[model samples]
Target chain A: MTKRIQQFLNEQKPATPCVVIDLDVIKNNYGSMRTHLPLAQVFYAVKANPAPEVVNLLVNEGSSFDVASVPEVDLCLSQGANPDNISFGNTIKKEPHIAYAYSKGIRLFAFDSEEELLKISRAAPGSKVYCRILVENEGAQWPLSRKFGCEVEMAEDLLCQARELGLVPYGVSFHVGSQQTDLSQWDVAMTRVASLFMTLQERGIELTAINLGGGFPAHYIEHVEEMPAYADAVMRAIVGHFGNRLPKLMIEPGRSMVGDSGVLQAEVVLVSRKSNDDCKRWVYLDAGKFNGLAETLDEAITYRVTTSRDGEETEPVILAGPTCDSVDVIYEKKEYSLPLGLKAGDLVQFHSTGAYTTSYASVNFNGFEPIKAYCI
Target chain B: MTKRIQQFLNEQKPATPCVVIDLDVIKNNYGSMRTHLPLAQVFYAVKANPAPEVVNLLVNEGSSFDVASVPEVDLCLSQGANPDNISFGNTIKKEPHIAYAYSKGIRLFAFDSEEELLKISRAAPGSKVYCRILVENEGAQWPLSRKFGCEVEMAEDLLCQARELGLVPYGVSFHVGSQQTDLSQWDVAMTRVASLFMTLQERGIELTAINLGGGFPAHYIEHVEEMPAYADAVMRAIVGHFGNRLPKLMIEPGRSMVGDSGVLQAEVVLVSRKSNDDCKRWVYLDAGKFNGLAETLDEAITYRVTTSRDGEETEPVILAGPTCDSVDVIYEKKEYSLPLGLKAGDLVQFHSTGAYTTSYASVNFNGFEPIKAYCI
Candidate 1:
């Protein structure tokens, strides 16, 4: 074990499952992003892991917050974040929630439709709202283009509707996609967003913020390294297109900001060979895909299984959760191995699990807290 | 809405996001499974939806239960399932869980390793254990070959180990992957399982039960009609192999028995657009991926999205959850036209959600119950 990890394990209270967030790592991540884009207002997308400690750390690191729901807004408010510093960046739906968010004095909201603009106007009159454009991340498998955001043709109509509804149109927002590996895609998206800005200005609407929505990859995975290149390209495009005319440049980064800072530590509940198949042996842990990480099975992100004990090595094994369902698996590869022969009670830490690993995928299918998260 | 669905919805209090289980639908599903596999013991895998009401319904319908973890065992027991009937199918992990399970008199265990046999010997002593085999369904995209089950060679060793430990090695078990659409694949798996049963007999192990582990599909979408053919092929294969000597056949059917019984009814919270594009519109619901049928996002389980007001036409829309993360989407390309335009406060029902949708996915992502489940 690394001296630091050993100390961390010693400090823990033997919970079979829990999320440990290293505040030091978080601060370092914050500094890294800050160093790369000094001009962009960094808003930590709190939905990734909105634990109070994580939020507090991001706030302490001088980053604002981007919240999509009322509970998230409440979480930030409870943590003493000024409402002015928050952006309810999702398209507002519930008129009541819009009023509630506005009542809490939240100003920066993201809207994508004329209907949503009309509803928000009815709920929170004259609210400052950002128009989200649906930028196509061409070639991405799971693109958000089909679900949310305005296509280029409809973007002007929604912006005009917001203006008509007395919702002060701030700037524009666009998300390329989550875990975006292609850095140059942002350049194409930026050009589209810039054109929208020009078109909106021609329609007599002055914007205040241009939110490049969060999709920055930040994990120990191989793909996370591509984030620096993506971030650089995004920032350069923002500067190149908008330049002095840029609204308050906002970047809501969820995975990139905190995904690496959190480690999901679970105990190897049972390690048993199912058969003498040429495939990998099975190792069941206390955690599963229900914890919002089906990707372990989807093979989206790889998990590096490590033990807290020093001099341990990995052996190839398949990983499953304690759930009775056959689909309850975390890792599917048989060729992978851990250094330590992970037995039932040994702790296995999955690195770079800070983001959607817990908050987004938790289902108490087996009736257990997904994982109790603690910030270091 | 059907009369059954109307009654169920009428009983629910307006919670932001919750699961509603129609008791009538559950009974119907149970009956359907019973009618088809009249002789086979139906062990309702509690890992699907462990709600006591759901389990109780199965018990009343004359179905036994299968549990993996201790809590699941306790959940079934608390619901009045016979302790002897509840199979603790997962390999024992913690000594305490095993000890407790044995004290509760759980005899049917799925054993996969040498350590598990040793634990069972020390804990239950006289427990009847089933040797789990890793049957490969070559057609399954994410096969279980690497996760659980022993290889044929290891099974012989493990069964020998069980006999040495004085454990009652009763039978063998294998599961085709979940949401299995291909019925022909089960033929290959069963052939291998039947071969293993004979192989074990050759090694002087008299096997009793040959459990074809559950991967029964439930129609959440139009393609769900494929389930019946798959079931027929499997049952015919099982009967063909053993020919009335199929030693008390047991199938751990979780989703098929109750998947259509449960519905994820969520309130549409926000409807907005994707930024930097034109035509993309997002319908944000109060429920996020944390609970509102993440199987739709994770496994691409296509669910039928409809309104409580029956006969209403649907609209093409992107459904999102309330979680702040961009990845917290429910439907990506699932085109469904709603009866009316989805506003903030209307209820959206996801059909065929009785299985892995609710029980397995609820995490306290935002310190909220992803879904509140109630059986009608």
Candidate 2:
């Protein structure tokens, strides 16, 4: 275990499962990002970990926000973030939510469809709008399907239509997919953005900015390239694609910024063999898919788990959450080894789980309390 | 559209996505279960839908509760349910929770492990304990994995241990799996329970009650046999296996009791083709996996979706939720047909969504509001 996790465990001594976020690590992560990409501005994706403390820390570090909804805009604004620095990143939004964000003085927004652009025109007139281009998210840890962006033809039409409807055709944005590991994915997305930029330039529209939506990978169970390596690859790609005429660039880093700053501490509810003849042992934890770790869906993100009982003989076990729901098993097919002496009341820590842990927690499924977060 | 749904849409005119529950349907479903299984006591599983109105209505009907946690016990007690009618159904529980339930005058509980039995003995001494026996959940609509229950030998050992630990070895319980459609699955499970009962009796511990844990099916896209058919099948299987020496019988119904009583109304955010050359259309709704319809995990439960503009020309479309996440796609592999006229601001209703909808909702994911429910 890292010193940060050990210190947190020693201090908090949590009886119930809780997420501990180290703000100092977040600050260091922010500094590292700024040091690597000197020209690019950082807009922390608020949806990843919307804890007010996380937002406030980023705000103190002079980070902008890429908000998805009216409440996200409000969360950033409430934490003293400037509304001018916030962008509505979600393409599919309710009209009233658009108006609500507009009422709160958020001018920049993202849209993919003509209907959405029309709603933006009506709700927030003359606002800065970015059209997202659909990209292949192959090899991404969490491969996003066709959900947010439109095709190149649709993007071109949507941008031109935005100008016709009295909205500023501000820029282009694209997400390579969350927990994106491969650096070449950024090159592919940036090349597409560059092509769209030139197409729009030929159409006599001068775009002012390029919003690089969040896809930065976090170190979980697997090793990823360092932050500076990703930053170097991104900067080199942008320069190679756009050369000297790069638009005012911004990168929204959700998982990369916060994933390593927190650790989730959950206690073992029980450890038993299902049957005497059964091969594997079952270790059940107090926290599960519903309470905090909903990102464990389909085992997309594999978090490294460690128990307080260390340096003993280890055995492969099927990890499960403390719920009557059978689907709540966290790890079964995958081989997860834990100390053989692990039993009930032992603390188990899931490392590098800050980003998607608490934000996706359900309030009361199977009557378990939502995962609580404590910031240090 | 069903008259129940049409009346709801016409009457409520919900501007945002909401769950509409018909109390009359719930009352009728409860009455049907009682009529079909006259000998079995009803313990409505609170985790299905923890809506206060549902609990209070069931309380008025004198229904017992199979609660998973202390808050569930408190919810029942606060709703004026008698302590004797509530069973602490979850085997995985914290020590404080057991003590709290005991302090609240709850005596019936379930356990499947030695550690749990020890905790109960220390906290809630002499409580009526049930040991859940593990069985193959074959052919069930939602086949549960090995997250809950233990094997026959484990159950026998645990029950015997419960008596030695100063607890009442009261009964045996087993879940055939949620949304169970196969009647023969129950026969196999009950036969195992009978064997365990006889073994426990040989050890001088008389097991009085038998908890036929929740598995009852609900009508969704596929047709299920009515309540009487299920009850009759269950009765026949019990008589065939137990041979008239049935213990004090109880049935915990979660989905079947309330599933058909509710309808979820969500407005279409947008309807568009992925590209000009693409064949199928994509229909987006305000509610998705994170908010209310979490039962869509792995497409285990296929809900029937309809819109107010029914009977119009229809086309196969991909359905998705409003969140920015890619995994939020509700239907992609499956072919779901919707009206071609479906557009922004049009209302779509998902039928038979009363159970497991709102209770599993996250508080705020991508800043969307947690799904709200209303009762009539």
Candidate 3:
């Protein structure tokens, strides 16, 4: 946790199961990316954390936006963001929503299929569009499937189809996955993306931009390479294929931009063993899969945790949320060691939960309100 | 879909991604449960669908409530439910919440561990408490882990401690699991519960009740036995051991009571294949894992889906929600056949979604509001 957030928690003593974001950390994360990956324009993925404070900071920093919906478009615009700086990033959108964004002066969009392309053609006519190519997400912690992108051949057809429908086929895009660790995966995606750019160029449809979608790593339980390592790998991969004259470049960073900027605090409601001989004690926390900590589903994103009683003797324990649903478990098979003295009312903080936590919380599930947030 | 909901959908076209609940279906479902399981008092599990309309209807029908949180307790009381009829049924609860429920005149509470029991004794002294025993959830579609219950021996010690701490050691409780299909699982839990009661009786701690926690199934894509069959099995198991000297038996029914009473309608935003030769088409709906359909996380609870065009030639489709998140895909591995002519703007209704769908929705995960609910 950042010093600002720690100080805020200490001074404010907000209720349990709330997240605190340090704007300084967000600014620093953005600055570090700018210092390293100088070739690409950064589009702060708004869906990561749509808090007005975060968006306002990014807007002041001259960061463009990657929005998923009309409400997100309005969020950025209402925060004094330049309409030209926003890109409608989600491939799935209602036709009316597309028209609304177009009316609000959004000129760039993302599409993976013909139906979406057709919608963009009619709704946001003449807008610059990028076709997401389906690439291998083998090494990402939160790997994506065939849900958001299409095959290289289909992407080729779709981008070409965009031009015929009075739209600009401006770029090609692909995401390795969220929380991507393997630098080589970028090389893999860039290879196919570069190949597609060439094929489209030969057909007299020259694409000028490559939207490098978000796959940057966040600080979690597992160690990942530093930002410079990612920047160097990405630069080298791009130069390896498209040597001298590069296309206009853009990067969409979601989790990496704000993930490490906040800490989520929850109180232990109860801790007990199922049986006398049970090996693991189940530690029930006031916050869980519903309110926050959704990335803990399947233990995919393991966040570093610290307790108020840290440094005490610890033992492996099962972690659960305060819900009647059986699937409300946070971590069970994955061994989460806790202080043996931990009991009801002990406080615990989950690190690097700033991205998907508050944004993914359920709306009053089991009569529990969504986790509250405080931006410092 | 019920005739009432169908007519309501036909007449009043509320926006897509809204659930229409037929109060008639809820009343009938409760009546059926009452007719079949005459020996057990009904406790409507409020976590399933805690709509004020649903709670008010059940209250008028003389149904007790199984509440998981303080907000739920307040919701029931605010809707004119008798405080005596509400059970604070969640094993995990905050001390302040317990006190609040107690101050509101709630007398019944659930506990599974010594720490929880201690909290209850300190907060809600003299409240009637039931100890939950860890039981096998075999043959359940959504099997629970060792999250909410303690071993039989642990339960015995806790109950004895409750009596010493000036709390009423009223009963023992166990859930087979949610969406449980196997009838024999009830017998398995009943045997353990009976053995615990006998052991407690020998120790001079006379427990006067046995709470059969919710394990009842909701009608989904899978065919389940009628409510009478479940009532018969539960009755047989309880009688085989208790031999007519039955305690004040209570059965908590969450999904089964309201699961079949509602239908959720969503519009097809787009439908396209990932590749030209790809056999399965990808169908994107306005609603997704975040807004609704959280139960389809692992395709565990498959709701019966019907499109506006149902009788045309059918093809297997990969269903997904309208969000940027990759995990938002509903049923990719599970083959859901849809009409070949299904396209954007066509309406689709998910049947048996009344219970868990609306209650589990996320709080605007991707700029989409929580699914609207209409109780007709």
Candidate 4:
């Protein structure tokens, strides 16, 4: 945790459980991602913790946004984001919502089926649409063959249908999955998407952008591989297939860009002994499954607990929350300790909780207030 | 599903994701609980579903409530529920919220420790307190021996301390965990609580109530044992321990009262084959881990889906939701069949989702609107 964060934690009233974003960390992350992927324009996936301040920071840093729904698109627009910079990345089935997006000048819409093509034709008329193709690859973290995309075989028909409707088939896109640690999966997807784009060009359809939808791994724990190598591989695959004529690459990175830049802090309310002789203990904090740290079952992502007090050595402690339900536990039997004298009134801070922590999670369980974010 | 419920589903506007509760079923469940424990006054745990309409129905039926938080207490009070009838069953350190409960004439509170007792003495002077005793029965269903309660030996000290502070020590309480099926284990808790009450009486502390904090099992699935016989055995043990002098018995039944009363109606968004033979067909619904169904991690409470169409023969299908996260799956490899023609936009309802279904959970994952209840 940063010194300014420690001082902020010390001064907080502790009346409400909240998520705090270190704008400096976000700036660093944005700067690093830009430097690494200089060729690819980054569209910050606002679905992961879409606070106005977070969105504003990403917008100020020259990052576009990938919005899945109207509310998310509206959120970005409300934060002073450029309409042309926003891509409605998810397949559109809701005709009215699609028409609204088109009216707002969002030309970069993703389509995966004839039904979506018809919906887009009827709703957006003459909109420049991106055909979302399924890139089936073995050994990838998550095969895109699951749902919500046109099969490699169906891509031609879908693109032809868009052309028949006079819709601009601007590009191809594919999302393998979220938290995809493997870089080989991007190479496989790029290879498949490149071929589809060439076939479309052969059919006399000119494209402008190829969107590699966001699924970049957001590592919370240390020692997880960084993404610069993966980004390089993806760039290589694009050049190998489409050569210098490869459309402008657009990568919408959600978790990676913001996951590690935020911290959620709550006061410890109770602590219990794991065993009579076991040194480890279970500490119950005010925050629970209701907020950002809800991926308890999927232990791939976890927050690192730190004390605001300086020079405090860490000990392993299982963190529980205040909800009455047993499943309300935030972390499963993990060890992370705080200050030796951490008491009821003392605050415990969790790092790397910015992404998908608060924007999508706020139910007000136990009458606890929603997370309040403080940027910078 | 009832005819009225089917009609309601047909009339509802097409929304991708929503939770619909049947008011008629809720009333039926509430009535059924009264029939099971005819002798004891029913205090419907308001934490189960604190919606004003839901609370009004339960209160109008002559059922009091057991509230765990100030907001819950305030909710009941707002619906005209008498404060004297409600008990603050949570056993933790009281905040300024305690003063509000006291001001509302909520005299009853639960206590588990010496530290909590001291705080309560200063915060809520002269309040009627219930000593939450921790029964040291290893075989006890949930031995809440962790966190909230005092040991059986500490009961003497607690009773003495309550008297010393001019607070009314009117009763004793014990919880055998939630959704516990072991009737024999519950008997052990009753026996221990009864014995502790006898010891307190011998020590000149006359109690007026013995609260067997409710853990009555509701067989959400088939072939599970009923709770009536268990409740009878527990009552018999109380009578056996104290003879005719047993205090006014109270039970904090949360799930049993509302667990079976509610069903969640979700729209099928998409259907696809999970296996080549279509033997593993997946019917994706709108409800996911964000809702309460995800709490049944070990199949403790299983929800069965039924279509609104008549003669809806069941076909085994895996259920998933629209969330991008892989873990958003609600039913994995679980077999359930819906109507043959049931496709996207068709309504499928899950049974036994009343109590902890919506009130105890939320759409914290996608930040969607909270579940709305219909009283039809």
Best by TM-score: 3
**Which candidate should be chosen as best, given DockQ against the real structure?**
3
Model 2: per-residue Cα lDDT at residue B126:
88
- Per-residue lDDT tens digits of candidate 4, residues B1-376? 5677567667875453545556776677667666766667677777666667878887778778888677788888888898888988776434566677888888888876665566677778999898886654343233333554656777766877899998988888887776666666666777777777778878888888888777775445554466567667777777677787767878778777766666677776556552224455566666765665655543445676667563856566667765545555666555566666666567777776766666545444443455556555
Estimate TM-scores for all models. 0.88, 0.96, 0.99, 0.84
Per-residue CA lDDT of candidate 2, range A5-97, in tens? Answer: 678679868656899888888898899989988788898988889999999999999999998777898899899999888988888888888
Write model 2 residue lDDT over B1-376, tens digit each, in one string: 3476568768868756788888888888888888899889999999998888999999999899999888899999999999999999988888888999999999999988778889999999989999887888887888988778889988998888898988999999999988888888888898898888888888898998889998898898887878887898889888987787778889999999999888888889878775667788888899999889898877788999888788999989989999888888888877898888888899888889999999788878888888888887
| Model 3 pairs in collision | none
Label model 4 with its docking quality class: acceptable
- What do the candidate models score in CA lDDT, each in turn? 0.72, 0.87, 0.92, 0.69
Better of 2 and 3 by TM-score: 3
Pairs of residues clashing in candidate 2: none
Q: What is residue B200's positional error in candidate 1, in angstroms? A: 3.1
Model 3: per-residue lDDT, tens digit, A46-125? Answer: 98999999999999999999999988999999999999999999999889999999999999999999999999999999
Model 2: DockQ against the native?
Answer: 0.73
Angstrom error of the Cα, residue A134, model 1: value is 2.6
Q: Please state the error at residue A348 of candidate 2 in Å.
A: 1.5
TM-scores for chain B, in order? 0.91, 0.98, 0.99, 0.87
Docking class of 1: acceptable
- Greater-lDDT candidate between 2 and 3: 3
